[model samples]
Target: MSPTSASEIISALLDLTAWTVFDVDPEGRILAGNDESGSMQLVEIAPDGTRTQLTALPSRCSGRYVPGTRRVVVQHDNGGDEQMQLSLLDIEPSAPPADLPAGLPADLPTGRAARLPATLVDLTPLVHDPAYKHDLADVSAESVVFLTNRRDGVDFDVVVHDLATGAETPLYDGGGYLVDAVASHDRRSVAITTLSSRPRSTQILVAGGEIATSPTTGTTGGHGTTSETPEPHTGTARPVAVTAADEHAHHIHVAWAAGDHALVMSSDHEREFAAVVRVRSGDGVPASAETDGTVWETLVAADDHDLEVVLSPDGSAMVVGHHQDGVTTLAVHEHDGTHRCDVTLPDDGVPTVIWAPDSSRFAVHLTASGDPGSIHLVDAATGGVSTLVDGRAQIPEGLPISLPTVHRVPTPDGEQIPCFVYRPAGTARTGDENDHAPYSTTGNAAGTTVAGASVVLVHGGPEGEANRLFSPVIQALAGAGFTVLVPNVRGSAGYGKRWVSLDDVDKRLDSVADLAALRAWLPELGLDADRSALWGGSYGGYMVLAGTTMQPDLWAAGVDIVGMSSLVTFLENTSEYRRAAREREYGSLEHDRDFLVTASPITYLDQLRAPLFVIHGANDPRVPLSEAEQIAAALADRGIRHELRVYHDEGHGLAKRANRKDAYPAAVEFLTEILGR
Candidate 1:
């Protein structure tokens, strides 16, 4: 077969549709959905892998089955504005008049195999505000708990909606923003995680809105500064000091264990990496609270990377997912955090694991370097695994796939950057180690010597991560005979928190330095430095623009997808709900304006030598469309070769399938032309 063209690869990938599993039913079936027409239609997957569409609603909705009931409580919103409403869906099959059961619970678990008429019960009347967004917290037998934020408020207040009467009541207001809330298995208490006390800080609160603290006050620790413990709450709930109240500390709720009497969470309080700790209800304050003592029970210590835990329903065992380097490592552990054994998952890819309702089995969605990916089933008892669904099932036949090879490049600053390298399928790996022969001499499958260009694919989030996953865009570039190097540069998550925060605020230029270091080391890996292009979306896009401007001659071309050109303007224009979080990552607009302007890509545009291509969604809320417009206009006026493509119906990123189908191929063509393909 001939090498796949850029257009061929795009078509093969866009032809497939991907479904993400959200909730699992008691019958061991899966609940998954895909977004269409700006709404997600929930579907039921039988044990035999057959999928049946369950709901047909006009608005976007996601449903969670009511415990022990045939009804699913759905949270939906109009036109994707995210102001969600509660609705009950009864999917029980229609029965004959004589077979009707008497006194059924207000909500019941519905049949999986039978095609039932979905009855929509509007619970939106319970919430008076039409502009407030609602997020499902916990669905209990008696009530449904959720968090709601009005247009006028910054924090989300927890509310409980009773199933029988459809009455809603306010539960708690943390004074700060609510991060997450989980009801105990027993449903007696709810564990709420909040970041209200300080910027990027975390606090855990048990039900009744109580703040648990030590009996004695004035403990010294956290930032090496002595902190006077706040007075313990004598109200319905107590605030437990899982970590010190340092402004830099961030806690993410993992799960509630020991029958809801304890909380399991991950925190980077004083450590470089994040660790998982299980805090009992009355610990008052963690030992880390006492100037010099061990932190909470230390369920799972960080091993140079971030650790995340998912406890089974019974809390007897857990799957400890460790993000080391750039890949996920799954290991089984006792509920108390003792090492049990390892559960092997696909290497060098992101794995999303979901437990069966009974916890006896788990479904892991793994996406590797090529093709879309696959969902695998794992036996909890033996760590055995099997494929449950192939994410690449819809790919056209005879399309080639490329896998990524992981390598670490050491920087002068002593940081080891992990790079995922993808050489086109037939590229020769047998070249001499000492020859220093570049990629131009590599032979393709057709046995012809091809001068392979290289492209640096940066990922977004800066705080987000770029794992080894099935990226159609990356593979398409490689299929067109280009070598792709995706680096999880500093400030990227999955690495230790300290490394992620290294590029924060004024130190951002250090990360751009890492890009120069990456390009300099390319020749050693048999890649061409002169023919390389810089490409990324979001934060990665920011890096592309910055790299070309800061290190003007390093890249042959550049692509930015909804990336910010001016950090100052971005903060002033981005969505209100995201401004605070963005400030925490990029720095404050009011006080750090000078630093932001210095770090902005636009400030250094005069140094750019690479031709550029910019893509954006007209409706982007995170980095507004104006960010792209300003940069494109500036580049045009400067007489630099550039092109800008804006999708009118898109937002923050290219989400719509049709738009991606058109945008990606065009992007490939642009890069290929500039790279001399």
Candidate 2:
């Protein structure tokens, strides 16, 4: 039989999906985002790793198990507008599945013994404008707290709902923007954090029923859209300041700690890096509380590296995740930040630590170089690790899996760029498997010695770092005989703030120079530099355009996925909720139009000589479909070879499984045709 081909790898990847855990119940049942039927839905994973489908929502849904009840509160939205609506799912054993929600595919399997039957209850009816974005903040047995932008489309406000009475109460409209909210375990009070005073200060609002307020106008009760002036009610809410007004502190509320008495958060006040701090959760009546100030104690101090904290469910322990040069290091400590111990893992990548209800265990979505990602159970007390779900289980047996080697490629600016190099494995073309001819025939082009066609894969989030993880696309390319290099360039997260901020605003082009340097460095690693291409999504997509345009002679081809073509236009016509945040990374359209145009790839499209392929979602709210359209139009007018794919059902990225399957293989085919590999 022939060896597995790139197409086979892509097909196998289609059947694979990674689960992101949201919450865990006392019974050890976990609520998570999973793709059981090609669409993301809520799934309950038993303590033993047994999987059970919970909801058949048409779109992606994030869920949390309601304490002491058989209920799960889920947040979902229409298409990909990100305006989520809250829904309740009664996941009791005897719950009937009759009268399922409309638009649920008729072909969905009716019975799965492992799955508890569930009934969907639309909670959106409690809010007036379901058109605005709503997010789940916290859930208790009797009530649920959510943040919504229904009142003003710009800032989010806190809203609490009683599960039993269906009574909705507006809590804390202290105005600015609500960053996050966490309900106390006793359900008597809630702590809300506002980031209105960014980069310098923050306010923590603690409120109870005494401080609840609901607007008198715009009560749509899930029906008409008559905008009425909501009679605002001022509750006895007490505001606690975490940082001084003059300090450059950025306070981010993380979670409720030590029952309902305190909260855990990250504050960069008077420090270069953000550190964890535990603040007093004042009594419902703030005037009577005996706390000296808002901040009670510093749980974790800011060290040389930035910190990410994950508190145990019982608030007994905490996990500190920090990164250096793109690899993550996790340390476990007591809830009070004592007794620290580093977690021993087999590989290095960003592992999201989700603590179980008992605080004795944690589930980590672990990933490594050449491995997509998998869910692993970690012992909180002993720092032990074990696999719960193997994300690569979908790969066929006997296929040669590729692994990456870390290469420290030095840049021109005295920086060492960490690059993960994945090479194709060798296989016997005929007869016994022991016959070790290079597994792929595609790489042995003329004048190449033991080297393969190369591709530089850039990751998005100029603020995000690339980690060693299993990516089907990278595997497929390697299987097709290409040497794939993924670099964590400047402006990537996980590498301290200074490194991440290197490409911000006017310094953006320096990262493009690093891309060019990577191409020049490829030959030293025995990879064919002349036969290489550039591919990335989002910011990485933007890198692809930049590399192909500014360093046209360096790349054989380029593929851009939902990348920005014109920074100025993107800022001018992106979703209002995201425009300001994006402007911070890319220059602002209002004040820095000329700077944005200078940084944009569309401005230098005439310099691009290589063939290009672009993919985008028509309804993308961030990058928008116009980014792709404009580039495709420009390339066409210039007579450049290119192909554009616009998926109607997708937004931001190719999130739909069917769309990914169709899009990825087509990408491989395009590279094959253009690079002749």
Candidate 3:
């Protein structure tokens, strides 16, 4: 076999499609998001293996089916702006139409169409502004609970919209960044989690006449006041903090349980990891009182790893996702916390589980490094797992796909950075002239050898973890004969709260130092230090620019996608609602302006030596396109080798298949040429 070109390898990997099971209807029909039509679209899969494309909007769309109804509340946004709008789509499977075209207009009429079986009704025109986001929180038979920032464009307010009367009621008008709000089964009470009180820590608030918020208050040695004014609602009752306002920083999430109870996953009680706990409102409390009696019961005790739980709608069972290292192990438990059986996954990958309406079984969406992805149906009682959707089957026969091997790189400070290494298959020349070795042959391409080069791929979020999931970019780089290293440096999540907050505020540059440490240890793994490059997007993109600028002689080339060059300018120009939230992590311009400037990659552009390729979305809301433009201009003015590509129809990242096909291949080609691969 001949050596495959970078473009050919990238294109082939990008052609693979993956779908995730979002919600399952009562009729055993699965609602999913499939990227088969060039972009992720709403899809419905019947129990008999029939798949139907629901929405064909140009932008990616996702939604949940209204409980006990054929109507689905769709959510989408324009280009890559994060202001999502809500709409209602009704599907009539019995009235199937003939030969619908591949790509339909985004603004297709609302009524029944001659070429489709779904009617899309634009709900944004009547309910909320398209300029602001109206994120769906929970949908019930009586009403829809959503959080919208339309009123002030900064604070999200919980609103309950009646499904029958079309009346919208503002349940809680608390001014803060609300994470999630869930209404009880009776819709009389609501539970919400917010980060307004403290940075990086979430406080739970229960609003209703029945349950009283906990009056416990104290400082946590962090920023902001733990005390909050009782927010008055429509009635005489107000929303109050249910969790104790103590010195410990707690990150809690809530969902409605059986009756008047709410399932809570909290990191409090002196525990380093979050644990599942059940809470409910006790009787004999006045509606206007400051303290409504509340009872708490521990369900699953905190262990060494963090836990994520999803309760079945019928309240019979729950799926517990145990987060340890970088992967998840799912287990089913009875309503009373009795362990049923641990779910056996097809591969060691990240899995997202959603319960069926009946609670008899659940759908597990599994994604691994070696395969594209697949969706499996698990029996809640027997723990039997069967494949419902297989994306691995679509891969062309004999195509090489590299699987990651977990490795830890020790830093100078003694902190070991977790990383996944993907080496090219077949024999490759080591650093020494006489040395030769054969890599793994699991996904081997015959006659292909390592290019003696490597690419360091970084994940965004600074809070996000780099797990062993299917990545076209990583696979493409490995297939092109360059080894790939995905590192979860300090400030990345999944390790614990302490690990994630290690690089906060004044310690921001420490994460970039971790990258330097990773680069220094590359030679020990038989990788060439002179041919290594940095590639990342968003915060990861910021890392790429920072690594190249801070350590000028370390990398041969760099690829930045929608990355920020200056933290000060980025925080100032970011979306208004997002500014405060991001400030908590990156530090605020109001007080830490000097530190922000010092941490910015743009501040040290004069030290940059590596050739760079910058890719950005023209309408990006998070980092802004200006971040990319400024870095590219500075590089040009300094006579540095660099290139830039801006896509007008994109936001934070490339969502469209056409743009990815164009941008990624060009980036790979640039890296190959600059590294002399």
lDDT of 2 by residue, 1-677 (tens): 33465666557656667567777666777677767577678787887778877776656677776666767777777666677787766565443388889998765655422244333332324333446877777765556678887767766777877666777777766555566776544444556766533222455666664212221111001101112222343553655444343343456646666545676767665566778877663452322223454445677765676777877755677898775555667889898899567788767776777777667777787776545567777888888888777766645575556777666778987998878777665522333332322234443222123235778999998767687666778877776667788998887755555666678788999998989889888766555678899999999999999999888889999999999988888888887766665775677787888989999898998898989889998878789899999999998998989999998877888767888888888987888777663
Worst lDDT run of 10 residues, candidate 1, spans: 216-225
lDDT-wise, the better of 2 and 3 is 3
What C-alpha lDDT, on a 0 to 100 scale, does residue 509 get in candidate 2? 96
Order the numbered candidates by TM-score, best leading: 3, 1, 2
Clashing pairs in 3: 80-651, 212-292
Per-prediction CA RMSD (Å)? 7.4, 7.8, 7.4
Candidate with better TM-score, 1 vs 2: 1
Lowest summed lDDT window (length 10), candidate 3: 216-225
TM-score of each: 0.84, 0.83, 0.88
- Output candidate 2 Cα RMSD: 7.8
**For residues 1-677, could you state the per-residue lDDT of candidate 3 as single tens digits?**
33355566678888889788777776888889888888788888889988888878778878877766777777788887867777776675324334556587644443343224333342323255768888877665445677899989999888876667677777787778888886654455667777753445766776663211221111110001122323334462557676654433555546656643455454544566766777655762212212556666677755677777877766667788787767888889887778989998878888987777667888888998766778889999989998878888887765667877677889999999988888764434335432223233333342134366789999999678898889999988887778899999998877777787788888898899998998898777667788899999999999999999999989999999999999999998988988998998889999999999999999898899999999999989899999999999999999999999999999999998889998998898888788753
Off by over 4 Å in 1: 1-3, 34-41, 55-63, 75-87, 94-130, 195-201, 207-241, 281-295, 346-348, 431-450
Query: lDDT of each structure?
Result: 0.69, 0.69, 0.75
Ranked by TM-score, the better of candidates 2 and 3 is: 3
